[model samples]
Target: MGMLKLEARHLLAAAGAAVMISAPASAATLEVHIGSFKNGGTIPSKYAFCVPAAEGHTTGGANINPRISWSKGPRGTKSYAIIVYDNKAPAEHREMMNKEGVTMTADIKRHNFYHWVLVDIPPNVTSIKEGADSNARVVHGKPATPSAAGVKGLNDYTKVMAANDATKGQYYGYDGPCPPWNDDVVHAYHFAVYALSASSLDLPKDFDGPAAEDAMKGKILAQGETVGLYTQNPTKGAKASK
Candidate 1:
């Protein structure tokens, strides 16, 4: 009887090992790449919403969206999403922002400023060409619309320029970084890609970053990101890319 019990236990253990060996592996993290700059490297002025100006603190840049590509999502991934935002935006303090004497320190209060929010990208679409979303600055901002690549959603620039007559409008799609010129801290722009289980979030018209995030919820399968640094401050060693 003791020998029979020991053999039963051995059989159970063997079965457990077989089950473990046959089990599928977890999904791998997607590999994201930025064509214009290295990950965690400085971003060029050509891809910025603002750049160093000869006379003023800053001026409108090329505003081109850098080329981006990503690895295919794992099995069960139906679509993908791209979100680009600045993680080091200065806090709301009008008096000190852009002031020549004021130095926005690294420890200053910061917030996320969304520059691009595109969703519902097809699984087969693995890359976006340079300037495909935005080639130059639009005076009143581009129209919020959907295209072959994905749905272009409202960026933070809409709120940032709401009070300005010349630039005020519903800014959409890829509007690149424009860190405060007086800021002493270098800003990090995160270009993230999300692999989703669903084909579409079905976001509402004129949807923003928060709205997209709400829609993504539990549908995200895998995600990856690459960071690019930028600062309009001349002392930070960034030259205007003309």
Candidate 2:
């Protein structure tokens, strides 16, 4: 479990830096780690602009690409996919869904929330540049892969803001967090690295997190990740919690 754990859910909401392969990955597994200019090339800073946790700080011009670095890709690993998610979301995603308007209730905290899901990455790529996907929004059903190579997957954010045109669109790529304006603890964003046998996970069209994971099941050579923490409440941003 990367960015977000399966059971992790943030009631108030919102959500690493690292690398240390204690065990050898599957025959040169494609490893991904978070890094930041503030953390000396580690994971992205919890105080970045896109995150609600870093609300008042003004992001100091921090970019979205979290300085991801990787190594030891699996043999014949055509390409790689990275996913960042928040484990602290409402257990049942639709529990808060309503007819006229589905709203995220303040009481409905702690649920599975997927912040980012990227697919079809070029196997040759080791990592992404900082701020590459940050808070940018693209088109619907379009290929949202990086200019280098690959395609984008539908992140959970798509359905979240779909009602409003300005924010509506298929989140085919990365979309950072801006969780509740108020909350308790900082949310954890698990950055998972998967080494796949194919260039992409070929599942039914418009697959989500669980779907993608199932498609890649058993096919994954190895996976590893580093986590970063962010909280809507600024006090929690301290390094100790990370």
Which has the greatest TM-score?
1
What is the alpha-carbon lDDT of model 1 when measured against the actual structure? 0.78
User: Candidate 1, which ten residues in sequence have the lowest lDDT sum?
Assistant: 15-24
Worst 10 residues of 2 by lDDT: 11-20
Each model's TM-score, in the order given? Answer: 0.86, 0.65
Question: Which residue runs does candidate 2 get wrong by more than 4 Å?
Answer: 1-30, 37-63, 91-109, 134-147, 203-205, 235-242
Clashes of 1: 0
Residue 55, candidate 2: Cα error in Å is 9.6
Model 1 TM-score, 2 decimals: 0.86
